[model samples]
Target: MAGVGLALRDGGDGGAPLFAAFAGAGAGLALAFSPTLTRAPATVRPEDAADASGLLATVTQLGRLIGVAAFGTLFLNRLESLGASGAYTSAEALLAGMDALALTAVAGAVSGLVRRRR
Candidate 1:
């Protein structure tokens, strides 16, 4: 992740795309389970605590989704506008990493969800 940021700053050899995809996928998978994990009743049921925790988890998930979208968009836009030179373009590497994370996350989430259902 840190490498991605640096590469973006220094303009690497088109490695950012891979990083972004991984980041996006990770973000998606991590967030997708938010609701289910939140709503699940503990064997020992912590009552009010469990409910609060679930709410917190949901809120965090929302934030994660927002971040994922933002990063994904930034990466794609940067990639498309490779001809342009600016801070935005410089950010492409990090954004790419983030996108990759979120993309992976989404795929993992869908798979996990399906598996859980079965």
Candidate 2:
């Protein structure tokens, strides 16, 4: 759904496609959070469950911080290099950042699947 919305973003439909894409992505992330939080601690012994949960939370937060920082840097760099053409440059920067993020996500997913298979 998110992918469909993203692919339709260039249709010039008054931002509806982008909004739907973001909404779907947000919903997907929200849905995954609970199961991930629950499952992380379940892998530990009873006494270590609390510690595992805490570690999972800490790592999740740190990853978010790093991802945001990296994406911000990429966007800013692209925006600057594009010579400040206003909305067009900004859009290009955003697209570049999103593309990088999507690639990173696909690579991570692939690596995770490979590791699980091994």
Candidate 3:
């Protein structure tokens, strides 16, 4: 779901409606997984389930915050660089940044799969 959203954002051609749909799809997918993923650790460690769940949620939020902050900074810097040369617009920079993040995510997914196989 997020993969699809990222793909759309990376090549959305500045379409607001398409981005909105992508966001909706991604949100739905995350909502579908939240319960199961959040509950699994609890099942394994009942005594500390509450703490574990809280930690999981905290880490998840932190990961999102960090990803956005880091990528946003990168996007702004790239935008500025391109603007200085009169070579690119804000939309282009946004797409470029999204593409960068999408590629990184793909790499991370591949590495995770490889590690699991080993």
TM-score of each: 0.38, 0.77, 0.68
What is the C-alpha lDDT profile of model 3 across 7-90, one tens digit per residue? Answer: 444444536666675776577547646765765685666788779878777887897899889989988998899899996667
lDDT agreement with native, every candidate: 0.62, 0.71, 0.69
Q: Compose the digit string of candidate 1's lDDT tens values, residues 15-60.
A: 8565774575467556655655655544435667767776767887
Top candidate when judged by lDDT against the true structure: 2
Number of clashing pairs, model 3? Answer: 0
Clashes per candidate, residues 3 or more apart or on different chains = 29, 0, 0
Descending-lDDT candidate ranking? 2, 3, 1
**Per the 3 Å backbone cut-off, how many clashing residue pairs does candidate 2 have?**
0
RMSD of candidate 3 to true structure, Å: 4.4
> Is 1 or 3 the stronger prediction by lDDT?
3
Q: Which of 1 and 2 is the better model by TM-score? A: 2
What's the residue-level lDDT of 98 in candidate 1? 50
Q: Candidate 3: lDDT of 97?
A: 72
Candidate 2: segments with Cα more than 4 A from true spot: 1-14, 84-88
Model 3 TM-score (2 dp)? 0.68
lDDT of 2 by residue, 8-118 (tens): 435354366667777776876677577767766777998987788788889999999999999899989997987565545455666677788777766866886898798
